[model samples]
Target chain A: MKPLTTGIAGIALLAVLVLAPLGLPPFAMTLLTEAVILGLFAMSLDLMFGYTRLVSFGHAAAYGLGAYACGWLLLNTGMPMLFAVFAGALLTGIVGLGVGWMCTLATGVSFSMLTLAFAQLLYAISFKWTSVTGGSDGLAGIPRTVGPFGFAALSSKAGFYYFALACLVGGFLACRALVRSPFGAVLRGIRENEAKTTALGYNTRLYKIAVVAVAYGLGGLAGGLYAPFAGFANTELLFWLLSGQVLIMVIVGGAGTLVGPILGAAFFMLMEHQLSAWTEAWALYFGLIFIAFVLFAPEGIWGLATGLATGRFRPASERH
Target chain B: MSTLALLLTQTVNALSQSALLFFLGVGLTLIFGLMRIVNFAHGALYMLGAFVGYSIAAWSGSFWLALAGAPLLVGLFGAGFELTILRRLYRRDAHAFLMVTFGLALVVGEAVRLTWGSDALQVAGPPALSGVVFMLDEPFPVYRLFLVAIGVVVAVAIWQFLERARLGLLIRATSQNADMANALGVDVKMIRSCVFGIGCGLAALGGVLAAPLVTASNGMAATVIIDAFVIVIIGGMGSFLGSLIGALLIGFVQVFGNYYAPDFALAFMYLVMLAVLVMRPGGLLGKEA
Candidate 1:
């Protein structure tokens, strides 16, 4: 999408999201909060996957670490929510820097497997450290501290929803600026042809590692929000299934673009909510839809929307 | 138990576990070797085989029949899936294959839950192998011994088939260069479907063997798949010898790690895998990427 059109569409969508809580019931308002938080998570993935073309198979590591750290800080310390969240994100970024550096040594599927291995290690520790993580039952009653001035908004459902919305929009703009900057152009070059980029004396590995850290930092920010919003953090947050779930949202919503994955996340959560309410075997239906999208609508929802606008439908494969 | 008995029992445990891991890893390696597509549904196929084995054994009143029937039926089902869905996907890149197989895993997993229900169901060890044996005054189930023997026999048989048989030669040739083999008159598509079926069959075989020990449940796939990934990474993806060696090493790590460091057994395995991956991305015995 062009900058002007995407800007307009984004504002219009933001307007709708802002007003949605007024019309929604308590349950729906809560669900919307969950969706927005998840959307931010998916957008973080888009930063690496869509732009950098790094298919991280274990992104949940960053998110899960953020959740655990944020939960731990809130429960054990008297830090404000905002500070705790920032600390969590910063910690994940540092970890991402190290893990990403090591993983970037190998390319393609090997890189993916390396990422997965690290996440599995974290999952193992989280499961075993019962005292710290609550093991299987997970950390519970995570206190949500109210803001810079001890405002009560962080404690309420509607208030948390707005806070999450602000984070999403802010994160989105940060991502947009990152992708449009010269650093982002280097990332795109590396994504397209790393060998050529390297030949151009661009230190492609450093760029790749940089993006992974930035991407995971934002992912941590999203997870930090989740711990407070959900009032708990579980081992499942770090599981590979969540990684796959977020990846599906990014790809199916339309990778290579900033806004696509957020929309995809909202669509997925809403559909899951509706389907699971009607049938226990909703995954069966969801899987079928997912398979169909891979087989047919390979460009994903955003691609279909843009294709319709241009009035030129094309069958595109899964290409970076 | 004495120290000798404890050592003996854990060795047996590790060997049996390695046997099951071999069955899962070898097939995955074969598929990866030929198609370069990791079968995410391999674990689901294993779980499905166990569930199907349970139902078959329940109906037939024989554990042996399930061992034979589960793999055969699942293998056929895998072939059908290949012919229908995967045939069209060879044109796309690796990510598409991963996503599609993941979708397949979800579908198969949910389908199993719907068909067999969510509760774990036990499959009795065959009565012929149900008797206990003592080693150093420690009683051991003979069925686990049978699993080890079966693993060795399958490994040897697969080795012979690949190293000696005409079909094995054809498979090797195709894996080396599919287009060249196709140009020379080998049916490439047929070879792919056959390999995929064989891989799924091996996974099912592992599942049937494991059912007696672990019981049939949906979560089995989640646990085993992670093990498979660790093994694949350590053994090197697409390397048969690498998988076997990797599986045994992991089996020991998991068994002994559980004994010595019960808190971080899984972590131990991953740490080993990470060390191997960092040192040699192609795996211990596998070619360097």
Candidate 2:
């Protein structure tokens, strides 16, 4: 898409999100809040998987850590919401560096397995360590204080909704800037041909680690939002199921496109809500839909939408 | 029991567990070795094996029938899934394969839950082997010893098959370079299909064998897939011998870890995986990509 068009579209979407509360009921407003948060989480993954070619199968570890850390802090301490969220994200980023270092030792399947194992390790910790994590029950009754936003600015439903929307827009811009920068060119370089990137004297491993930390930090940011929004944090967020779902959001949205995952996350949440209401075994149908996307619409929902707009069925195929 | 007796019992316990691990991990490694596909649905195939075995056994009143029938049936389904669904994806990149297989895992897990009602159903061991044997003045389940014995036999058989068999040569050749193998007049497609079948059959066999101990449940696929991959990653993705050794190593780790520190046992297993992963990213016996 043209830069002008993309920018205009982004602004238009932000405006719509800003005006969403005017139409949405309280329940729908809450869902929108969660959807935007999930979109942020999906965007975080796309930074690595879509851009850096680092397909982590254990992304839930970062998000879950963010939620747990943020929840624990909010409950145990008197910190406001914003600070706790960023604090949670920062901790996740630091840990992500360590995890990413080990995971980056191999590429493809091995890297995926390493990430998965590390996530399972965290899951086990959360499952057993009842004193801190609340074991299987998970940390609950977390405060929803918006921190510096004061008691009224970011505490209520509308308050959190605006906060989440602002965060998503902010995150999208930050990621867009990063990807447009020289560092992003290196990530694209690694994605296309890591060996060539390395041959060009770029420390490809270092770049991989950096992207992982950044992506995971953003994932933590989303999780941080989630804990306060949901009024609780739990071990289910740490499961591989969440990782797979977010991955689907990325894939079904359109990998390598910043706006794709956000749209994908929203579409996914709506579908999930609709499908589960119809049948108990919604995952069966959800998996089938995901498979269809992977096979037929590899570029994803965003790709299809743009293709329709541009009179091209396979827009990504003829791109640079 | 004395320390020596306790150690002996634990050793036997580890061996039995390793037997199941070997079946599950070796199948995964074999498919990965030949096709470069991780076969995430292999765990679901294992779960299906147990569920199918449970129903068949209940109907026939024959544990032996279920063991034989389950693998055979599930194996054909695995090959069919490969031929019909996965075959279209061979030209795609590694990530595509990963995601597709992951979708398959989700689909199959849900299917099993729907079919089996999400309950853990017991599949009894064969009456002939259900009895216990006296060991170190302690009674040990004969079925477990049977598991250990069969595992060794299957391990040796598989090793020999890969080393000596003509089909195995085709698989190894394809794994190295499919185009070259095809140029040599090998039916690459058939071999790929058959290997997926055999690999899934092995997983199903493991499931049938494990049903008595763990029971057939909705969560089996999720848990077993992780354990299987842990063994596969530790052993190396495509190495048969690596799978065997990795299975034994993990089996011992889990058995000993549980016996010693029950709370940290799961964490301990992952720690071992992490340590090995950091030290040798390709795994202990896996080739560096």
Candidate number with greatest TM-score:
1
- Name the runs in model 2 displaced over 4 angstroms: A146-149, A315-320
Q: What 10-residue stretch in candidate 1 chain B is worst by lDDT?
A: B280-289
Q: In model 1, which runs have C-alpha deviations exceeding 4 angstroms? A: A317-319
Best by DockQ: 1
lDDT of 1 by residue, A1-320 (tens): 57798779878989999999889999999889999999999999998888988989899998999999999999999688878988999999999899889898878777888999999888999999988999988899998887678767667787788888999999998988988999999999987888999999999989989999998898999999999989999999999899889999998898888788988898899989999999999999888888898898788789888888778766664355
Interface RMSD of each: 1.2, 1.9
* lDDT by residue for model 2 (B1-289), tens: 9898899989999999999999999999999998888777878889989998999999999999998999999899889988988888887766667778778887888988888896789788898998988888988999999999999999999888887999877888888899999998999999989999999999999999999998899888888888998999998999998999899999999999999999999998889988898888888998874
DockQ of each: 0.73, 0.66
Query: In candidate 2 chain A, what residue range of length 10 has the lowest lDDT sum?
Result: A311-320
Across A52-109, the per-residue lDDT of candidate 2 in tens digits comes to 8888889999899999999999999969987898999999999999988889988888
Docking outcome class, model 1: medium
